[model samples]
Target: MTAKLIHGYEVVIGFETHTQLATQSKIFSRAATAFGAEPNTQACAVDLALPGTLPVMNREAVACAIKLGLALGSHIAPVSIFARKNYFYPDLPKGYQISQFEIPVVQGGEVSFFLGDEKKTVRLVRAHLEEDAGKSLHEDFIGQSGIDLNRAGTPLLEIVTEPDIRSSEEAVAYAKELHKIVTWIGICDGNMQEGSFRCDANVSVRKPGQPLGTRREIKNLNSFKFMQQAIDYEIRWQIEQIEDGHAIQQATVLFDPDTGETRAMRTKEDAADYRYFPDPDLPPLHISEQWVQEERAQMAELPRTMAARFVADYGLPEYDATTLTQSKAMAAYFEAAAKACGQAKLASNWIMGEVSRRLNMAETGIEQAPVTAAQLATLIGRIADGTISNNAAKQVFDALWTGESNDVDAVIESKGLKQMNDSGALEKIIDEVIAANPDNVAQFRAGKDKAFNALVGQIMKASKGKANPTQVNELLRAKLAG
Candidate 1:
């Protein structure tokens, strides 16, 4: 495949995401990891890295890492090492962060998703276990900054992706897919607003066939919209800089959503700059094969596997299956409706088209939809059994969605939406339509398909759109032939 070029330069992007694990306690301490706590209230001795405090690994945090490995089809290492990432910040009361450096818990996985109609896969470099540093509160301090240690020592799985992403759209899609996997597996809460899931995008641009360009890291992109905007602005900024004879420098940048631009924060650091050394406090972490097996046994049916099953069993298109299984609620709703109605394709179409449109317009999720799966199933069944036309089904759906009626049959009956299925009655309407439009009859007999469609439309209109379309077409053809 040819690389997509932007203004004669190829854009390359990589992601380093910090996914906060859902564990209640800190990674090395018993301090609470809950959000929105008072400053310094949740910091314990181990979290603060006080003298005589030895770091003890949290068992639940390791279990969460194991679950993430299972979800992503990554290699869960039997043994991993912890290192101290030395840094200076007022928020880092420990003066150094305990993180995995040499060997990570999860390694070598690929996340696949559809970009438009094309499927794209992003390769994972590693997901290392790390502890979050405390947050620095700069606002409302009257020129003095306050540190919030409540978030200190929060367990984090820093997932690193390869530089396979070439566009902002693909980057956002990859982030969202990763978010879904982490949240679906119950390893992370996946909240971007509360800083549960944060992303750092390394963006660069180079001329086609040239070596990779210098990358500047965009730190702490908490929202997908800001992520794309930041990458795009950064890409353009780099391209313009190179064109004007300014060399692109490696630095950490921050995205200011208010101004829709990226500004340099600090020089990007390399591995040696951090002076990584194995932590003496914590010993080498070991995981038995039995533990991985236990985690696999407890895993739920993943979206990818479920989508393949849908394609095989339900005879749905790959796109339909993938879209339907985007979330557990959506997948369950689709499966229930498809099974109940025995019209998998119809159920998929309605859910993807009308149902999704309504949900997006309302800025809500499938779990909060007004129409129940059973109700939608009954409506689809009515359409399949020729009890109502497609147009009538839309009307019934609107009533159900708007809470105008709870019962499917009640809405259909109340709105007089029953299809005119009687062969004799439809034949009468077809004969009248044929006689009333002699020209259309001549044209359809002369092989004008549009004329046939026009005649069907006339018959449906004559029946007040209540005619069974199949019956009308058959009777219309027979009358025209005779």
Candidate 2:
């Protein structure tokens, strides 16, 4: 229903997210899981399900899953069982996927996220460790499609949340929080474009006191914008069907980006249909308490904790802290720059404005930044200490991107871009500006405040745009008022 409809119907949402572990090798095989490789180039005999091939679990993938569980404040199971989910598809060479069925590695967690002024918590049902299936590419240029087994057997952490969401906004907030957690905990890279992270939303609408409506699963929504849109469309479609006296069907749906609509791909399959059973080829996953403790100790400060610290220590607002701590690399960059400049607010402003702008333009991340945190700190320091005017600092920052010197002091000195901070020298320029602009002085004396700004502009021009702006403004106002 739209926001205008107040029929007392509530929308419930749950999410199942698959986050590919940031490991070099696949979970069940030694095949490389790198993206953009030629089709089937990175596959191994085990990944291809060749005869006499046995699967061995990757230790790093398990550790990464535990790290995520700790970050979510979840209970880590000492032992979890893996089962074979039998399905027949071209991409599934073995006709079954190794996944968690009855006992998962992590369970009963909660994630707190902010929605505007209110902080909401979503309970996580379970986080299971699983292996990803291969991709089925359909290209008309080749007259058919082929399988890319590079993604096959890749380790994936499937995080499932309880149906605590009451609206589309809450669903988006939960997804964003999960994305941040995975990236902050160093488990997943959180690159939606590369398919490293993906979300599937389960949505249903019901009356306030009625039984829950049948839900539909929307699959493979990668971006946050698309996630919100897909949920909204699904909810509206379900509501309309119920109102029109039609029953909601339980099925799997795919979102069409071009039309911004959802279409049913197939009826949702049940666990019994998948024929889930223990795989004889692989042993049960045994996670000891010691292993869990060690991984927890290695867990970095999570985004929420880092955000709180940024607010407490750096005196930043909650919004600013949230933006700064969106990614671990971003938080590190902010902290390093803040330390070097000794002015946290100034560092934040420059990083959020100029640095973020450049990163967005280039479509890159903070880790792949052209300028380092130290370099940005030094540049802001020069501006703060009056070694370079704010305008000149932008120029210096642009020049620093060419892989030359990033030292603001060196750049200013080499380029002769230092600000003119001498008040006595600026006073002479202000006097000349007032004398030349007699009409403006007359207007100022007549109580027109805008006349003084013109005089300030003249002083700035006379200084060749190198005068300290605050010093220039003060001298011009004093001379004009006299």
Query: On residues 214-284, what C-alpha lDDT tens digit does candidate 2 reach at each position?
Result: 88999999999998898888888888888899988899999987888999999999889999998898787
- Output the number of the TM-score-best candidate: 1
Q: Relative to the unseen true structure, what is the C-alpha lDDT of residue 180 in candidate 1, on a scale of 0 to 100?
A: 89
Best by lDDT: 1
Query: Which 10 consecutive residues of model 1 have the lowest summed lDDT?
Result: 137-146
Number of colliding residue pairs in model 1: 0
lDDT, residue 131, candidate 1: 97
Alpha-carbon shift of residue 433 in model 2 (angstroms) = 6.5
Tens-place lDDT digits, model 1, residues 1-482: 78799999999999999999999899998989888877789999888888899989999999999988888889999999999999888998988899998899899888999998999999999999999998988876577778888888999999999999999999999999999888888888889999999999999999998999999999999999999999999999999999999999999999999999999989998998889999998999999999999988988899888999999999999999999988888999999999999999999999999999999999999999999999999999999999999999999999999999999999899999999988888888787888889898888889999999999898889999999988887887787788
Error of 1 at 101 (Å): 1.3
Give candidate 2 misplaced runs (Cα > 4 Å). 1-12, 23-58, 84-96, 111-121, 134-153, 164-177, 189-194, 205-213, 223-229, 232-236, 239-245, 270-285, 402-418, 428-467, 472-482
